[model samples]
Target: MRRVRTTHLVLALRGLGRRRVRDAALSVLAPVVACCAALAGLTAWAGAGRAGSPTRVRVTEGRVLLPSVGVPETAAFFRIANEGGSADTLVRITARDVPGDVTLSQHRMERGDMAYRSEIDSVSVAAGERLAMSPVGVDLTVPVPSKAWRSGDLVPFTLEFRRSGPVRVLAVVVRPGTVSPQ
Candidate 1:
């Protein structure tokens, strides 16, 4: 009877030991499994365009207006079109030939016919919409180069967007008072 009791005690202790080992292993593996799951989910989300509608932006009718006699800065205009399902913001503009930082500026009319121009940080382009930049509206204020810009000269510009990334476009140089082609 004593031997039988001892054998039962040993068996119970072995079972408890096995349970402890299994619990410890599960505790260690749980976090690893969770991390793997999270990584997979993130990868899938990125593959699907970062969990939202992709932004597709196209630039057209790009023109750079040369500075006139007394004007120190020139302006660049473009017809920006967003054809995707997401909205995007034009954050920055860069030119290879221009020396200084290109800035985004807007022209607004006040109470009367008085026009006001201000430097803007960014401009938003709604999804499936077109933003046509003109001299009297939103335009990029670019620093004028010392060398003169002739009409029909092509200037390379890179426009950075918040979501759509950088877009390279060549703008045709036009005279200050001349109308650019559409």
Candidate 2:
């Protein structure tokens, strides 16, 4: 009787092992397929971000000066670098603390006199070239006189671009002879 019971137990164990062979293989396959799917999804998301983004828009230099009220207007100078692989435009700029609105202006000598004009929409900055918006040649003017800004006072402003959007910065007001901050 003991020998018959032992043979029955051995047959039951063999049946259990045969039933799990397919299930054991599927467990490993499930994890492998899930990992591959996750990797594919991440790769596609990264590609989409790169396709839409512009390469880079940077502020090389920005400064604001303090001069006498009789000067008519004060100017801020900046150097914008468009490192993006494509061309972009400096569309508009705004300064809030200033008493008047901002305008992009250019100065040129015509017929033995200095001619000044406003830049309306945008200033093009080529892919690799630099756009130098200087106070002397190309200037950004405040239409009215602002409250006197002391040295070291921070002037906050935003420069808007065509493709890259707006960049906010603080222009440190300094004396005429003092060095400007970066």
Candidate 3:
């Protein structure tokens, strides 16, 4: 009876040893395979030819000119930089915080008359260059209430990029004759 018991114990020990070896091998192999798969996926994502695959944008500066009744429109400026290998565009501009409509406008000299025209299409930003859009002696304009904002006030504005989408920026309110360095 004692010999039978010892033989059964030895068989159980061998089974346990085999299981530990199998588990160790699987633990190492599984992570290695998973890592290889992850690397392959990342490589493929970067290889796709897309404009602004890795683009960056920020509000360089913002200012607002005082508005008067019937001239409730103000102008704001932005500086966009595209670090990607491809070019991008300013798709749209919106003021989610302000209580008015915002659109892209440019000053045009039409038939010897200086006028502002709305730009509905996206404004392109060339690769490796900075695009500056401003209001003074320029085209970009923002319409707002005449007495809505004061100097040194911060208004939330969003700049929509063609490839980078929308980025929110705080625009500082200034007097009508304020100018920021380029």
Candidate 4:
């Protein structure tokens, strides 16, 4: 009677499909596998068209101007140097610590009225040129107030390039009306 009961228990347990264990394991592991595959693809694709290293694009003298007494918005300046054999386009700029979007803007004279316009889509850097970002020319617009920005404050900035990927920069905050060098 003991041997017969053991055999019946074994048969009942075997009734559960053996493939159920494999299915459950696959369901748990599929998303992780897919994420790894997607990351690998992006890593390969980012290097497809770039001929030079990402370090060729450098940012120097990066600063965000402190907002004046009445102005709430501020401007940023940077000297972007492309020391590579291939030209690259600065496609995007992002700042996580700020409250507003970092927009690429340039002053335009429309109908004799000089205005700061957010019309620049992207800025291009030649093979061996240093693009000076200034308030008179193309600059980054941000909502950095005097309260938020102080002298010697460092803010994080990420500049995305068409060929070089993204380069991280630390922008220093300067005093109000600090004139950027020409």
* Candidate 1 weakest lDDT stretch, 10 residues: 173-182
Candidate order, lDDT descending = 1, 4, 2, 3
Please provide, for model 2 over 1-182, each residue's C-alpha lDDT reduced to its tens digit, 9 standing for 90 to 100.
99999999999988888879867888889999999999888788567554344647787556777766667667777888887766788878898887777888776657867665666566788765677766446667764345677777778889888888899978777566453323
The local distance difference test score of each candidate is 0.89, 0.73, 0.71, 0.81
TM-score of 3: 0.61
The estimated TM-scores of all candidates read 0.68, 0.61, 0.61, 0.64
Q: Model 4 compared with the native: what TM-score?
A: 0.64
- Model 3, position 81, has a per-residue lDDT of 77
Q: lDDT per residue, candidate 4, 133-182, as tens digits? A: 87678989887643566789898999899988998999998985675545
lDDT of 1 at 136: 86
Which candidate leads the pack in TM-score?
A: 1
Give one digit per residue, the lDDT tens place, for model 1 in 1-182. Answer: 99999999999999999999999999999899999999999889769665567889999888899778756788999999998878999999999998788899999888979998899999999988999998888999999887788899999999999999999999999887775423
lDDT of 3 by residue, 67-178 (tens): 6557756678766777676777787778865566677766555676665565656677766677676653343567775446768888777888877888888878778656
Q: Counting only residues 3 or more apart in sequence or on different chains, how many pairs clash (N, Cα, C under 3 Å) in candidate 4? A: 0
